[model samples]
Target: MKAALVGADGALLYEVRRATGRERGPDAVVEGILGFAAELRAYGAEHFGESALAAGVAVPGIVDAENGIAVYAANLGWRDVPMRALLAERLGGVPVALGHDVRTGGLAEGRLGAGRGADRFMFIPLGTGIAGAIGIGGTIEAGAHGYAGEIGHVVVRPDGPECGCRQRGCLETLASAAAVSRAWAAASGDPEADAADCAKAVESGDPEAVRVWLDAVDALAAGLVTALTLLDPRTLIIGGGLAEAGETLFTPLRAAVEERVTFQKLPEIVPAALGDTAGCLGAGLLAWDLVAPADGPAAVTGSGAP
Candidate 1:
């Protein structure tokens, strides 16, 4: 788990990273989160002469924000964890906001980064797994079950490799960074290969690397075309590790997206500004939004518009 003390001015006052200790069970992870928040609060009291009005926590998997329940996290082996209530009690009854990590990152990008001013936008993070956050009118549209933005699992190739979710040919199988690396390694007989090595090979014009890269891009473009047709988002912001390739990914991606569209207005494709910190900053924004006075606008710094 990662923790940060974000000031009212939007500056990160303190930040730390620690393991969730998943081997020890959900309760242990919850305790760690609570202890970390307490440490941040104590640090604030000593250095800033104030306490955090509220806290925001972002977690993976299906989250029911309205009910403050972490519905499921396959990675953490948790089901129905009452995160908000647990954190509220631990933080002396302060309000606690809970959100899905991808959605929160999307919210941050929409409000403060690449998607600013876009009425409709999508944030797709190409990490170990691929997922998306959809934003409309500055509000994230979490589906009724808080699974609205799970675009990664959309089937793109019917006969593709098996996925962790017990599915085959999902977009995640073909397009995610992990999938790219795995595919390259399998094709080249390099057990130790990873996505970075694949990208490097592609840059060097290796035939196997070119095939793997093009196939991944094609799969991603196919899924994105579906997203564009369904949501008509004005922008699509790409982040996570694969995004670091810059034009190496975007140039081909943009062309593919355009090719698939016949009449729809093409969305602007761009990179995320906040990078990996987007989730943390987005969590802070959500907490601040929850506690700020409803009658007036809260102060915003950096790039976000009120």
Candidate 2:
């Protein structure tokens, strides 16, 4: 678990990281989050000389933001957890904002990072699993039931490998960081090989590595094309572990997207600027929203939330 207290200017005032001790179950994880928040609060009071008016938290899984509940999180083994209320109580009645991690990252990207100024954008993270955040007009659209941008589950190869979600050929099965590594390992007959090794081999012109890389890229492109056609977003911001490939990923992805588009305006594809800090920054934004009264459309930059 990780926690950070961010100032209204988006500066990290205090931070903490600790193991979730999650083997004990959901209660432990919830306790860890609350404990971390308490530590952050103490640090802020001592060092920053201020108390936060509100708190924002981002958690993995299906978060019902409107209801302030974490509906489900397979990794955390939590279901219907009232995270916002818990945090509010721990913090002594401060307002709290809760959101999904991916959506929060997307919110940061849309407001202040790569997708800034884009009316419509998609933030796709190609890490252990494929997931996305759709932003329209500076606000992320969480969809009905708060599960809108689960692009990873979109089947790209209908007859391909089975996925943890009990489906076959989901995009995550082929194009995610873990999937790419697994595919490369299988192809090379080396159980220890990972995606980074595979990328290195591809860079050295290894035929098998190139093949695996191309296949993963193709699957990703297929999924992205669907998103582009459906949303007509003005930009697509790629982040997470796989995007570490930089131009090697973007060059091919741009070409593939261009090939798939017939007459639509192709969106500019770019790397995320905030790196891993996006979620925390976005959480801060949410907290700012809770405390700072909104006069109109929230302006970008150091102007707080409103």
Instruction: Give the alpha-carbon lDDT of every model.
Output: 0.86, 0.86
Per-candidate clashes, comma-separated = 0, 0
- Once fitted onto the true fold, the runs of candidate 1 whose alpha carbons sit more than 4 angstroms away are 293-306
lDDT of 2 by residue, 1-108 (tens): 666777666666666677888899889999989988877877777776777767899999889999899999999999999999999999999899998999998988
Least accurate stretch of 10 residues (summed lDDT) in model 1? 293-302
With a 3 Å backbone cut-off (N, CA, C), the pairs that clash in candidate 2 are none
Tens digit per residue, CA lDDT, model 1, 1-306 = 777777555556777788888789888887888898888877777777778888889999989999899999888888999999998998899888999999998988887789888889999999999999999987788998789988899999989999888899999999999999899899889999988888888889999898999999999999999899899999999999888888889999999999989888899999988888889877877777776622111344443211
Q: What's the TM-score of every candidate structure?
A: 0.94, 0.94
| lDDT score for candidate 1 against the true structure | 0.86
Give the distance in Å from residue 89's predicted Cα in candidate 1 to where it truly belongs. 0.5
Candidate 1: lDDT of 210? Answer: 87
